[model samples]
Target: MFFFGTFRHSLDDKSRCTLPNCFRDDLGKVVYATKGLDNCLNIYPEETFKVLCEKNAKLNELDSAQRRYQRMFFQTSFKYEVDKSGRITLSKNHLQIAGINKDIVIVGNNDHIEIWDKDIFEKIDALQNEEFESNAQLIAQTYKE
Candidate 1:
């Protein structure tokens, strides 16, 4: 499925955002909230998350850095389900990890999606736009279809 949309959602006290109905069409019973690259929550379906875990597990677990990786990123991940109403009550710690505040951006990212703080996403998007504009030719060359 091609996941595509951008929306602003207000997070309630319980950290629930009414997930868009369209977004939940192909979703499963379980979902995961994990730390993302941009201090946002990366929401992954169970199947997708399992693939990631399997790939990570295959790495050298005996390596000290890998052990630390397991402790930090892996252990800290919070798993929750999309309730019948499509509301997910995020954990306080998970909110802190993603730096999420009142307003959030629910963005569809194809294989997965992300919940980003609105202001943060705006700031990052602007910078990315500028950089992309300046290096459009190089980007085109690097990402040719």
Candidate 2:
């Protein structure tokens, strides 16, 4: 399912955070998570995760950049189960890599979810908007229609 919306959340003392109810409803008990771009964590549902794996597998293995990405992608990825309370544990490595503290912002990014440090997300969001118009134009030009 397509995901959209921004949610504010917090991690408990156990390093577990509750996903939004809407997301929990769509995502089953288990999910795939990994380090994502811009210092955020990406959570993918089973089907989407499979699709991502398939796409990654198809990448040219001989290419150094693609090979490195494959290594990092697999290395940082993990399977997490959503508990009955709808919470999932965030690993220490991921938390450190993303610079996340207790407070966080969860963004529904189309096919997946992104978990970010609240302050970091805010700063990046502001910076991104500063060039939104130019970026939008550049993106729009990519459309063939």
- Candidate 2 stretches with Cα past 4 Å from truth are none
lDDT of candidate model 1 versus the reference: 0.82
Stretches > 4 Å off in candidate 1: 62-67
Positional deviation of residue 114's Cα in model 2 after best superposition, in angstroms: 0.1
- Please report how far candidate 1 places residue 136 from its true position, in Å: 4.1
On residues 104-137, what C-alpha lDDT tens digit does candidate 2 reach at each position? 9999999999999999999999999998999999
- The clash count of every prediction, one per candidate, is 0, 0
Span of ten consecutive residues with least summed lDDT in model 2: 136-145
What lDDT tens digits, residue by residue, belong to model 1 across residues 6-124?
Answer: 88899998789777777886656688878888778888888888888887777776899987776666876778888999978988888788788989999888888888888899998
Q: Return the top candidate by TM-score.
A: 2
Clashing pairs for model 1 are: none
Q: What would the TM-score be for candidate 1 when compared with the true structure?
A: 0.87
